[model samples]
Target: MEKRTLGTAGPRVAPIGLGCMGMSWGYAESRRDDDTSIQVIRRALDAGVDLLDTAAVYGDGHNEHLVGRAIAGRRDEAVIATKGGLVVDDLATKQMHRDGRPETLRRQVEDSLTRLGIDRIDLYYLHRVDPAVPVEERLGRPRRPRY
Candidate 1:
């Protein structure tokens, strides 16, 4: 499989990535089997698919755990992508919270690192923008809305 750079400074990864959301939880009833999911991830990597997309909010961090297990021995060969910010509870009510607060981001990133068994995440995204707080304030920087 061919490889491509994710960003100007990002690492090269296979063109295709495995979206592990289904293998973890969410989006209908959960039927995830850890062993199968891990095998699938391994197969993807063996086939040259290097990017894996997951989120902290997925399965309340269960997804990250699965990803961690799947990529245990192949960390250097894959690009891990995960998201943070959205909070969910037992009620399954997803509260879209903008937690890009620098401190929060730092903490979440650390937690994600621990869960994913990786020292650094290749990509991270804010799952949702918090309506209660201004984007600039939440992000701790100034920004202009793109038209």
Candidate 2:
């Protein structure tokens, strides 16, 4: 239950984090048991493992909802990391599309925050890179032309 810094400026979190993706989706089938998942999450937190990684794309946002419920009372003790940029077709179909446009990123983050019931995400990562758009454009930053 040792704490470690995620990055130079990032917050310190437990060394082990719960990856909630598999709990809700992936592995060729969904095994979403909110009750069990919540227990596991609570135990992890009680054991001092505070980092929880999830994504809006997982189970088409169901995973985030579950995690939100699990961490409701102990939000201050956890570090939540969720990804954006990939949109799922539906909760059942699980089809995906990448959209890293700056506007989309901003919108997705806002939506994710609402779904997760958190004011701010401790860590946010782009789920996939969109090749059609430049990284600078996707980040809403001006691109310095290469010489």
Candidate 3:
């Protein structure tokens, strides 16, 4: 497959990526199936679509959990990109709020790592910039912490 990247220094990835949001949550809650979702993620990787896009508020971390299960043995083959700064307030209504404080980001990074079941995330996106927080504090240099 042809390869591209998010930026000059980002990891090389395929042009197409699979969004794992609808798999576990969102519009069709009744049709949600973990097994099928896992199969889809694996097939995407096998097909060279390494960019698996997910987010923390997508089903309130349900999407991350699904990705964690799908990439259990083949994490190296996938480029996982997940977003933070957004928290799900109501699943049914899909209401979300942004918290971009550095302290909140610190906790978010720890939580996302735990939910994704990985040591490092290929890309960590800020879902939304919290208006109450300073931009420098929320989107400054990558905060490297002991994992």
Candidate 4:
């Protein structure tokens, strides 16, 4: 498997990653299958595709839980990447609002960690920037967030 660094110094992962959004939300809900999604993720990991992309906004954390279950015993084989900074307004419609407030980010990170059943996330992304909150404050401190 071809591997590339995420940034200049980030973890090296397969060039292609698994985007897990459609597995838990979006597209046709009727065709969504948890079992299949889990299998797909596991297969990707087994094939050396370690970057698993998910988001807290995706299925309002449902996707994270699904990814968590898929990686269970093979956590070390996968590099988990998930996003936050969006608050789901309605699960059915997938309506969400950007909430990059420090408190919100803090809570969301903790919630995501719990849902993913991981002590630390390998990569955490801010889904969207909240216009209401200043970028610096929303991100916490300096250029990067403390957490």
Candidate 5:
């Protein structure tokens, strides 16, 4: 498996990443099989595929849970990449809205950490940018909370 540097200073990862959305949600909901998905994720890890992409909005956080289970004993072998800032309006309809406020991101990050069963996420992405909020406010360095 060939590896490439993510961005200029990010971690080196395999050329191909395993997206766990379809396994838990997205396509063919009736065919969602947890056991098979776990096996596939494990196989991918064994094959040197390090990046695993997931998001909170996928199945309203189901995908993160599935990915967490898949990478349970192999945390060091994976680069868990997940997204936030998109709140699920309706899981059945796959409708969601962007919420990039600092508080919302903080909550989402905490929730994702809990759902993924990880101390820290390897990579975090904003699933969608909220036009109502400035990008800097969402992506900027964390400011000391004004109590």
Candidate 6:
């Protein structure tokens, strides 16, 4: 598999990143399988795929929990990436809203950490930009967030 650096000073990883969305959420609900998803993630790692993508809105956090389980033993081998900033108001209808305020982002990070069963996240993405908050204001002190 081809490999490349994620950034100027980031870890080297496989060119392909697995998006672990439909595995626990989206599309066919009758096909969600925890065991198989976990197996596939491990297999991907064994096959040189290190980046795994998931989001908080996916199944209202179910996807992250699944990812947490999948990388429990092999956490060192997987670079997990999850998104926040999108609040789910209606799980059944999949209604969501953007909330990029620092406070909201902090809370979301905490929830993500707990659900993912990890101390720190490799990459945290803002699911979307909130119209109410300025992007610069939201990211003024990106590294100074308490949560």
lDDT of 2: 0.85
RMSD of each: 4.9, 5.2, 2.4, 2.3, 4.0, 2.7
Error of 6 at 21 (Å): 0.5
Instruction: At residue 54, give the lDDT of candidate 5.
Output: 97
- What C-alpha lDDT values do all the predictions have? 0.79, 0.85, 0.86, 0.89, 0.89, 0.87
Clashes of 3: 0
Residues 1-147 of candidate 4: C-alpha lDDT, one tens digit per residue: 988988777788999999999998898867889999999999999889999999998888889999999999998888989988999999998898988899998898999999999888889878987889998887666444222
Give model 5 RMSD, 1 decimal.
4.0
lDDT per residue for candidate 2 within 1-147, as digits (tens), equals: 677887665788877788989888886454557898899999999999899999989988888998999999899988999998898877677788898888888988998899889898888888999887798888875434211
- Please give the distance, in angstroms, between residue 1's alpha carbon in candidate 5 and its true position after superposition: 2.4
Error of 1 at 81 (Å): 0.6
TM-score of each: 0.83, 0.89, 0.92, 0.93, 0.93, 0.92
Cα lDDT of model 6 by residue, 27-134, tens digit:
886778899999999899999999999999999999999999989978888888899889999988889899989888888889989998998888887889888999
Q: Can you list the residue pairs that collide in candidate 3?
A: none
Q: Write the per-residue lDDT of candidate 5 for residues 1-147, one digit (tens) a residue.
A: 888988776788999999899987879998899999999999999999999999998899899999999999898999989999999999889888889998998898899999989988878889888999998888879534211
In candidate 1 the C-alpha lDDT for residue 78 amounts to 83
Encode model 1's per-residue lDDT on 22-134: one tens digit a residue.
88666653465889889999999888898999988777788999999999988888888998777665626544445666677667788899999888888887887766666
Q: Candidate 3's residue-wise lDDT over 1-147, tens digit each?
A: 999867766788899999888987776888888898899999999999999999888888888999999999998899888888987789889888888988878788888889999998888879887899888778778555322
Q: Please count the clashing residue pairs in each candidate, in the order shown.
A: 0, 0, 0, 0, 0, 0
List the pairs of residues colliding in candidate 5: none
